[model samples]
Target: MIPAAFDYKAPTTVEEALSAMAEAGDDGKVIAGGQSLLPVMRMRMNAPEVLIDLGKVSSLRGISDEGDSIRIGAMTTYQSVLDDASVKEHLVLLHKVVETIADPQIRHRGTLGGSVAHADPAGDVGAATLALEATMVIAGSGGEREVPASEFFKGLFDTAVDEGELLVALRFPKHTGWGAHYEKFVRVAHQWAIVAVAATVKADGGTISEARVAFTNMGDRPLRATSVEQALAGASATEDAVRQACASAADGTSPPSDLNGDADYRRSIAPVLTRRAVLAAAEA
Candidate 1:
């Protein structure tokens, strides 16, 4: 397969990138890591007239620690995060999840922002971002705005990021090893998760202080199982309590049926999978 002939522009600045997008209008596409876009283009699924490359935008690449959260530049590669000593110390769960993101080659080339911007519901970054309650900073023609993780995901392969906007960075609350776990269900590595769950818990003297539960590929968007969270909070960090919370995973989801697995099977297995993830995270 061959892609449609298109113009390419690599911008070194945020303003320049936005301006390029504005000029190209609807026919222009932003290229971050191109991990997903290239494949789509090759398949002729998308035929952009112009491709705005963000590879040279310095402002969109790096990781920093904010007062209460970690701010990561959009261009940060998964490999960089994997090797980051700071991320390992404070946000180990993120590293844990990244380990399961595609394979080493993809990790080396894929940008975190690109993954989120692609808005694949089954992506590890999508679910992990939701579980961490992160915020995505998007800069557009008018100005900059932020979207919370819960609201950022709108549907499969869709997000709150608007036209002529570049996702600049991702901000997450400072994590101090709150029991965190990410469990992915796939027949093999590098496959889109049939269903995945990420769980984070804060424990105070063996009692659950706080809990966050997010699911991947269970619906049109990555979902936060708030019902499960509420049930786990302040409950004993026991298998029984984890099981109880897991039991309600499908309380509000409308999971879709697909070739990988059926809706009924995913619905039933999600809870059990989530329980194991919760327990693993609680032990962290």
Candidate 2:
């Protein structure tokens, strides 16, 4: 299979890209790195009339420190994330997850914004962003707008981005006063998660001051395990307490039963994975 014939535009500026997208309307699609989109296009899953390439837009690819957050350009590759000193010092959870995304080759081309925009439920970046409570910056014909991590993802293969909107960057809140870690369970060294968990725990003199738990591949979207977070609110940072809190991870989730594994298996493993993640984060 092959993508249908389409016009191509390499826009050097965000304003130009927005104008091109507005003109192309529903028949337009943006490509940055193209790690995932090209394969789907080759399979005929997406055949847009216009392909707007943002690869040459230098303004859309960089890492900078903002007042209260770290701004990562949409086209920043996963490998670059692994090497970013600011991200390593501030957003340690993301640093841990970037290494687990895929093999080196895939990491070299996969961008943070691309993963979030693609919104694959099983994607590590999506679940990590959810747990990190980040913000997504998007641009369109009208102007720029920020979408919260929780609201950015709508469902499997879907996002809050509207027509003519292109994701410009991701903003991760500072983790200066937090302890964080990311844990993923994959059958092989480089593969999609069987089930994954990301945990952020902030300590306040031996008591669990704050806790956040998020899951990957547990539903149609990357989700925060609110039940577990609520349960762990003020509990002692003990193994018993962590295990008990993890018990609530799959409470409201109708995890899919796909060819990878069954719903029962994912449900069963989610709590265990969450427990391990929380422990690692708490110890950090």
Candidate 3:
């Protein structure tokens, strides 16, 4: 289906983009890589009067190292992240997660900021970011402010990015020397994850010292499995220990019921995936 006609603005600078958004008000839409928004627009599910394009904004398209952490521009594509040595060395969980998102074509066009802002509960990036404790940098007329991943995702397809604001970048604290893995289950190749788990662990002398775990498609937003994380800490990094700790993976989740599986089915699989993710991460 064709999209409804709309006015387009390609702003080369963040300031200009903000101005355009302000002028369009409620009728405006900000587009990054367009991997998500364009599909919705073509289906006529969304028809903004003004389409603000940020592609020309050169500043929003690179990855930079910041000592203890790294900052990824909102417009940076998944391919770019995959190619960055810093990301591979410092943020292994993110690297693993991005590699599983769709295919090469989508990865080349999908931007981190776009996925994060889209806030889809099934998106692979959100679960990794939530587990990594990433921070979002939102730009608005009031200047830039940061929101932690824990508070950034509000609900299904919703986020903390308010009106007249743009997600300029994401800041991730480095998880160097940690074992990380992303375990995703899909019905077919390139399909959205039916259930996924992202885990990163820190171990010392074969014992788990710290752990962070989050889930995809297990709730309205990517959720941290706090109970599992607590259970994994100070535990042995073996299959038995990991499986026992992951037993409560579905404790507080509200997974959706669809053709792929029902809520109960998803609840049953959460622990299985969580155990796999944690054990693999511990071994990495």
Sorted on lDDT, best first, the list reads 3, 2, 1
For each candidate, what TM-score against the reference? 0.97, 0.96, 0.99
Worst 10 residues of 2 by lDDT: 174-183
Off by over 4 Å in 1: none
Candidate 1 residue pairs in backbone clash = none
Q: Which lDDT tens digits does candidate 1 get at residues 152-269?
A: 9888888898876889999988778687888999988689899999888888777888888888888888899998999888888889987986797987787878888898988999
lDDT of each: 0.88, 0.89, 0.96
Which residue runs of candidate 2 sit more than 4 Å off their true CA positions?
none
User: What lDDT is obtained when candidate 2 is compared to the true structure?
Assistant: 0.89
Clashes of each: 0, 0, 0
Model 3 residue 177 CA deviation in Å? 0.6
Answer with 1 or 3, whichever has the higher lDDT: 3
164, model 1: CA deviation in Å?
1.4
- Candidate 3, residues 128-168, lDDT tens digits: the string is 88899999999999999999999999998899999889999
